[model samples]
Target: MSAKVINITMNGLPMEVYEGMNVLEAARIMGIDIPTLCYDEGLSSYGACRLCIVEIGPQDRTKVVSSCTYRCEEGLEIRTHSKRVMDTRKMILELLVCSTPGSKTIQDLAAAHGVITARFKPEHEDCMLCGLCVRMCKEQMMATAIDFAGRGPDRRITTPFDEASALCRHCGGCMFICPACSSRCMGPDADTTLCSSCLNLSPSCVEVYDHQQCWMPPGCGTCIRPEGDYLPATGRISEVKTEA
Candidate 1:
């Protein structure tokens, strides 16, 4: 085979792809549809969803593979969609939807795959651990404020020390990028006095710092502020006021 040519059979059709190309890209060029959720165009591939599963090799000896992360090799025979592949994809989607019942992304994917209902109860109401938030936080934003705090089913996005993310820049990037957390809400300004019901603070009127302080860089220390502390320079006090 030529250095620039990569021979592969996609869906039983002989295909030639560029060397060092991923299987998903090649299949896409051939107009083969591979359902994917965690595969972004610019970010590194993190095969978390397992929706793009395919069988590669001869019909009798083919093996299941993830098309997103798998590279195309010379003389590789690939089945873009097969009974086993579809069954695996369906099960993966089922589990994901069950884990995140309220997620629009999961619901849409399930509908596309013809999954009417999930077999297992939702492990969680949201957050499928797809890593889009984490990746965007690290790669695009260049901030390691938020991260996967735990392992397996207990995994959750959190800041260091499980407190408010002090290193977070309050950019709201993770909240925006996350498919599970795609919600937009408008509230009073940060300086406005909020009701007790709306304010979930402790007894000391402490403000939970969810991101890195404007004065701090690459550290969470500067973000720490005592409860009832007034803003410096502005002389805004946090005194308890009583209406006459």
Candidate 2:
């Protein structure tokens, strides 16, 4: 038998997804780029990274939810690039960069979302605690070698008893899957936390309209606005296509 499907509206486009599919997977099917640090298709959905957040509900009253964990509901309306969603993503990127300054993954994600500066002081920590390594080890490698220990600032990934675990096969899956393990192009001692070298094109449609018309990976070209038309400096696009 075929899998049951659920219909949802994303970025004004209607799509049918497999039942129990999360918003992040649905958006990805439409070529929408939703940033995520903790999510991997092979492992279970752990909403540790809130980067793939989307705005849901009426325009006047929408709530932000982590797309990775939010299962699609029938007739559910989702805005992937609303003003509120963009703002929330930028803030999350800022915090991620602040926590781990040397992570190329975090820096690239922040630059893509137009987060140029991190206002908070930098901690220069190596790990963001996304738990990809832990999950990858347990789920895929079948070895619960390393796991998080402690609470708050004391929290960290460590082997049992802080010593090497005999259960570990040393398959290197944990380090291989870690985003923080990747180094930035600017090297470790760069004066800045954010490296815009891999910066993506700024999404202009979202600025003109309250939400974006384009949902491509870079999300800069192919806007819904007419080719020759431009919103006046003082005026914005008031018309928005929505789902019922």
Q: What is the alpha-carbon lDDT of model 1 when measured against the actual structure?
A: 0.64
lDDT, each prediction: 0.64, 0.71
Model 1 root-mean-square deviation? 10.7
Q: In TM-score terms, which candidate is top?
A: 2
TM-score of 1: 0.72
Alpha-carbon RMSD, each predicted model: 10.7, 18.1
Per-residue CA lDDT of model 1 for 120-173, tens digit only, reads: 865544467788878888888898877787876578766687776656676656
- Candidate 2, superposed: residue stretches over 4 Å from native: 188-244
TM-score of each: 0.72, 0.75
| Residue-by-residue lDDT tens digits, candidate 2, 95-115 | 988877656678778877778
Candidate 1 residue 150 C-alpha distance from true site, Å: 2.2
Angstrom error of the Cα, residue 209, model 2: value is 50
Please list the residue runs of candidate 1 whose C-alpha ends up more than 4 Å from where it truly belongs after superposition.
Answer: 1-3, 183-244
